[model samples]
Target chain A: MAINDNNTDSNKSQKQEEKDLPKVVIFLPPPVFSLIGEESFASNKFLFLKAYDSQLPLLQFLSTHSKSIKAILSSGGAAVNADILQLLPEVGLVVTTSAGLNQIDIPECRRRGIKIANAGNVYSDDVADLAVGLLIDVLRKVSASDRYVRQGFWATKGDYPLGSKLGGKRVGIVGLGNIGREVAKRLEAFGCFVSYNSRKKKPYVSYPFYQNVCELAANCDALIICCGLSDETHHMINKQVLSALGKEGVIVNVGRGPIIDEKEMLRCLVQGEIAGAGLDVFENEPDVPKEFFALDNVVLSPHRAVFTPESEKNLSQLVVGNLEAFLSNKPLLSEYVD
Target chain B: MAINDNNTDSNKSQKQEEKDLPKVVIFLPPPVFSLIGEESFASNKFLFLKAYDSQLPLLQFLSTHSKSIKAILSSGGAAVNADILQLLPEVGLVVTTSAGLNQIDIPECRRRGIKIANAGNVYSDDVADLAVGLLIDVLRKVSASDRYVRQGFWATKGDYPLGSKLGGKRVGIVGLGNIGREVAKRLEAFGCFVSYNSRKKKPYVSYPFYQNVCELAANCDALIICCGLSDETHHMINKQVLSALGKEGVIVNVGRGPIIDEKEMLRCLVQGEIAGAGLDVFENEPDVPKEFFALDNVVLSPHRAVFTPESEKNLSQLVVGNLEAFLSNKPLLSEYVD
Candidate 1:
């Protein structure tokens, strides 16, 4: 009877341990579309609250249940600023439902010994497709001509400058990652010969690999930025790179804005340093300089290269999957070393 | 000596005729990119003048040399409205660089007994490529998302939605002409099942032929508009047609704008009557309602689908060649019979 009682207690303890698993406080920084049908977290048992605001409120809420709060999931355009990271000292993990890790301070996470993982490569295909789309949009001047016809200017004495074709053009890819490779494959379909530059030549890739960006630019008709942003790559596309691209060449940036020298790019575009530019990202976003808006040759967007319904879902699945894997003690799919 | 004198006079008359050559008056509308380059018409002795702007000036100039105007070549997007046709009574022939005759009044030409020919099949490849590009852009949400990422909203919460892959999708092309045939071939490379709807079932076309638009839409996942704008095809994509396309279907219009009902289309989109639309032409252009301006579900462009540098130059060559053939009493490549 005593042995049976001990076995019963062991079973109960196992159930209790499963119920008491470290809580994951997912901070809902904003309302998701059709959230009414979404599943809610079980109360007092690994509770997940919807903040729909800043990390300060999240931190304030987490501080109240500090003992059970082992991890935090944050969302929205706002990044994990310094204030929130400093507040959550006991937090073991900070997960983001985004592919970019720029907003999350990796150095601070490293210093605090807290694990930081991002939903990287989830939107690679979506972004790559758009990069090619933007390039085509600019090269063909699709939007500009569309405006011309819609405005009844066809009846006037104006000319829609003939657009260049995409086929048989040399396309230089600055980065050879998932997005870059995808772009290469798609461009290849259109008869574009693709050449790329990366930190090192990838053995798995069969396309022509260049040792440097300038060499790639000099040989190609279009120089596309698909590389990541970092201190080393900050303003990498300076006057030198523009000169290498030449007057007949075009530059299309689908990567981070800091990777290009905005001031230099504008000067080059205005002075015909390069033929034209199709920019999706900017050095300072949502506040593009007045100079950029005035240019007709350049095709400028508000930096929304990966905003799609498919990409959104793909990224969410990756983030949620990573969280599930971490909780289950399986290795994270896209773990950030920092 | 008398025989020599007569031969000399005949030679002089021949030379005079060659020098005159009727001063073939050509009217080019707006948007003809290369404008029948220098060597193209100069060697043939055509006085090239654009009729897109200030038709009064062109009319006055043409009237002065009306007896010399044996032929007229119009290459631009400028419409040869009914008013323009009344002035061409003395003009022996009218040649257009584009295949579309919607802008030219065929009844007026028949009444005046003027021979008419147009450059056909020159822009089929160009138009087909743009149609598929629009389809991919809509299915993938290419432009909208590119707008989102470039705007620096990626660091924020949520993922873009997942898009349907084009591979294995059923594509119904509503014309088996040069453009539709080319589109089907391109879709084949993408692993898509191609079907077509034409006036008469094309015997040589390998793709399955659907006799009706409703039948084609019901069978296919996507529909492409590549037909001509005629009495039979006006408002072809009305509410009933779209209803047959199903709620998850996509429509890509590279054809004339009048074929689709703008009011009905907006209603269909608002009520989720169809999944999405990629329109290169609209029922009433340049005045795309404010409703379409903000939707990510639709992509709008001015009707410049047949635009490309190579195509423009090719079209010019075709126009010149058509003139040469007609002058030599040879059958035209693309003759319009009233």
Candidate 2:
């Protein structure tokens, strides 16, 4: 070797020497974004992994990658299964932008020691606002009014069915979390009596707290769901709850879809089991059952409770901040421990 | 006289039955009877006028058939113009359900001392509720959003523009009477700061008080018209006030239509002088200006602010009570003094 060849050899040796860097693989579901989804910088920073027909490609890529992949972020109704969690690169965190972690295999994440964080309190107010709007919409027959107005029946719509005003109604909340508290505040302003049912009664709130959903349903003129979804909560609002609501009851859901049994709800609505219902999240999203379309007493919005550009921007920024913190070995803003 | 023949020799039937009992004729507007019109009871009790029209045939018959008819009552929007007021019996009390005395020429009523009483403050809450609803509807773009959902736009509508939430907004009220106070209360619950301009500042209220409409408009993000309609107040919200509101302002009218300069409002709305408007009452009724139908920024509700059945029942009962009080030599529950 000549004198310059010695320097070249030294440069190659330095270049080959490297330390392990943490890798992040984000699984983004189809239609995960909204108008302002780009505002979430952290979510945008991760390497995107779309779930194709199979996770084989994902597993293959992760196994061969040299960087120590440590985290996975998924959004939308799409969930990460147990098998997928097993295939995930040795990671320390798996975060989701959902209030509920039903879709995530929590038990598997626990077994693997993967920390899980979710967008919990972040969307409470947004969902509560939708709940109130939906309640007002369905009870006031706003959809029918719109149809009547558009069809030029303005003059002949006849004495509009008077709606029970919000002033003197009893409202029951399924959960007493951030969303429930927000809803309680709003309903209190309207002079409604707000009661709540949770796993256990919260001592701090002034609302009448109950430990049973059926008891709450029996007492409240209207029922609103603002709880998380889980095996214990699955089909929690079943036939018994529906029957307890009686014929004059109004039900509004802004929580997970599986919390209420869709088939039972449909049957009750068909049989006039209850007065009306307002649903933001459904059993199946864009794939809403045809039965819902034909009902005049139901107000259905396609899982748009967490929409609104302001919230989206806020949530995105938070998500990005968390991602930055996680990658830097710093504490996440909302780190989750399985 | 024949029934009293035994004692007829004493008095010649008491001067021919008390001079024909002052033959009364009442000219009622169409369909004025059946407790529908606000003046039906007063017209019926006086027995001074005939109900001619089918809607008010009894009052017309009384007006036409009675020879010594000294009074008449007409209801609905049929104005007691100078011409019509002059044709009424000399001793007449012209009453109206509306707060405004314009339908009956005030000068004429004063000239004749016709003792007119209007159903004032009867629709204050209803009107105030509608004004607030209209404000929200316009600010929130409720109708537009409804259309967006119904039109299948969903999330594809390109964000739908982040609307200014009702919380933490300044609302300027043009009056501080029953309706205005109610509006202030409702807005207060929404986290809005309320200010008002009335005949005089109400120191009792905690809200900031302005002495002029222009000043109120200048300080407020939204200006609401709730003041009484009068010659002094007609066109109170003129170009100067509209200009004071600048470009990004909202106007809501639940007061009489003339209080706002309809022509100026049209020009401003067309030229983007204001952000949006909600108009329940108009300078003219039923026959709104064709241009009104063309504006997308304004909401029209067919002057139905007091259209709720609850309000209707309250109004009718109040009107009947006022009549009963008048007939029984008692003070009216709510008397209007001019």
Candidate 3:
């Protein structure tokens, strides 16, 4: 009986020591963590102090725990700007569960000497899969035919209109990065000829390079945008590029939507200036142009190109890895060096 | 004036000679000819007799033209069985503008020593493209997600359900014929591991062979039915096989529908025994089960797998090539030797 009581006390002390270890803070839990279940992170090295549970306001909660919170796990919805960063003076690192860091203030993080880790190539395959999937859906009219079948139109209207074939089409990939390269690989298997337009030609890439987006659009049957959004690339696919793509051309975008001039592209699609489009991201997401819903030549997705179950699992592993690396002062798994 | 009269008389004689060329009879003009325009075939060597305009019963029409009609050009809906063949004893060749010969009585054609040509391999690429398209649509939920966005569900519901990823999935192709091989190639580009079950182990193939479909289903994450419908293959994917595929399994059918037990498959899908399905061909096409319309896990297409514009062009060329070969007594371009 005495040995059992001593063992119970030691276990409680060990649990207390674990609770005293370094803390990682999350305001609003990321979708990945919630989807995978919060219990999965229960056995990790550090403690996760959820600010949402605090009775105080966010700024007040942060100021109260400023001395204890050493790391922040930011998600797409939570903006990690200078104001938030200034509240946690002891915070040394911020890890995001998304491929893009547009929500995080990068220059501010750098000036404050705080390190950042992103989702890296964890989502590249899923994003590329959706891009190619959207391309095939548009070219083959998969979703439109689905509508035809569901509406009982096939029996009433006879044979559906023939769709264009996928093989042997000329496809130009804008921004031939990780996602673009994967799209190119899959397209090559379908017998499509691949070319590219990037800020700089990739040294190891074998696909044809075009310096101008208009020139690339002119030579290809479809343009797939995979480049990140920045000031220079915003509206890169303008009216000139869409016009150069011609009336028989197609456009697919899995990257940020502002990279394309959405208004000009919509005008082209409406007037039959372009053949079709497959869009997963829009300039203003969740507020898609109502005009697009009436068109048969376009496929609209709900900006979920990177949210597969497999990708979510990968993202969870990456988040844990980044947090572990940050706690130990090791190199971050997917540090945003730029 | 004398020279002009002489040339007109010679042209009349040449016209008569042209009419004496070997005859090719078409009861109903094929859609390919109508699509490409009948003028495209006007310059060919053989003379096509329009039986539809004869103002006679089909049998009587064939009886009257039996001596002139050397070949019959049959489309998908046209039947070239023993009765039609007996009406025209002089007809030695039958050319069909479809891949499947289910419409023609193949055994009777063999018994009558009638040579046959089909639209061989012309639509293989297109069919394979659709198979892969449907698979991606199912795994990634492209059509369903498209519907969600179009119906304003994304704006109201916040986020759509996460779909399964395509990479690293173990896929079993039911048949390793032309279209199956193409499906394997494209899936490999996406990093999926492939195996197959076929009528016989192909000598030149390197993929692992499973003699039993149930075993294959047990081993793979998805099953793609690409085999033709025959007595032996009818209802091959029965209840036992579906059970072996388990709850996370997906099934994609680009093959004929009765290859699967449609009722059992529906039950499994409804009961959540299988994850999802993507069907292009159905047991009763153009009359899909009304129950499927309510299910979000399945993608319904109206049997347009091989009807791409490019494939139609290839089919036209094959038809012309077979007819020309038969007229000149050369080997048929796509002869159905069996």
Which candidate gets the maximum DockQ versus the true structure? Answer: 3
Residue-wise C-alpha lDDT for candidate 2, range A74-169, written one tens digit per residue? 675556777667666477677777777787888888878777777756676666666666666565555444444334355445323444344457
Which parts of model 3 are misplaced by more than 4 Å? Answer: A1-15, B1-11
- Over the stretch A1-338, how does candidate 1's per-residue lDDT look in tens digits? 45698899998997797657766666554222343223432223344544553456666865666666666775535566567766666677777765556767778778887777776776676677667767777777755554454445644634466667676689999988777887887777666899989888999788898987888888999988998786767888888888899988899898888899999988988998788888878887655666765565666665556655545555556666666666667788778762
Choose the strongest candidate by TM-score. Answer: 3
| Cα lDDT of model 2 by residue, B1-338, tens digit | 25576576556765565455543333444222332543534433343334453364443543444345544343555566666655555544555556556656778777876666666776676676667667765665554454444445554453344444565679999988888887887677556789999988886788998988898999999998888787889999999999999788999998888999999988999999998888867786544566765565776665555554445555666665665555556776766665
What's model 2's overall lDDT? 0.68
User: Could you tell which candidate, 1 or 3, scores higher by DockQ?
Assistant: 3
Alpha-carbon lDDT of model 1: 0.72
lDDT of 3 by residue, B219-291 (tens): 9999999887777788999999999999999999988888999999999999999999999988877788888
Ranking by TM-score: 3, 2, 1
List fnat, each candidate: 0.21, 0.03, 0.76
Worst 10 residues of 2 chain A by lDDT: A42-51
Worst 10 residues of 3 chain A by lDDT: A35-44
lDDT of 1 by residue, B1-338 (tens): 35788899998997786666654555654345455454544435444444444447766765555566667776535565557656656666788766577767677777777788876877887787678777877776655554454343544633445455565689999977878887887677555799989889888678898998889999989999998888888998888889999888999999888888878888888788898888887776545676776666777766667877767777767776777777667787677663
> Against the true structure, whose lDDT is highest?
3
Error of 2 at B217 (Å): 5.2
Backbone clashes in model 3, listed as residue pairs? none
Interface RMSDs of the predictions, in order, are: 4.7, 4.4, 0.8
Query: Poorest 10 consecutive residues of model 2 chain B by lDDT?
Result: B23-32
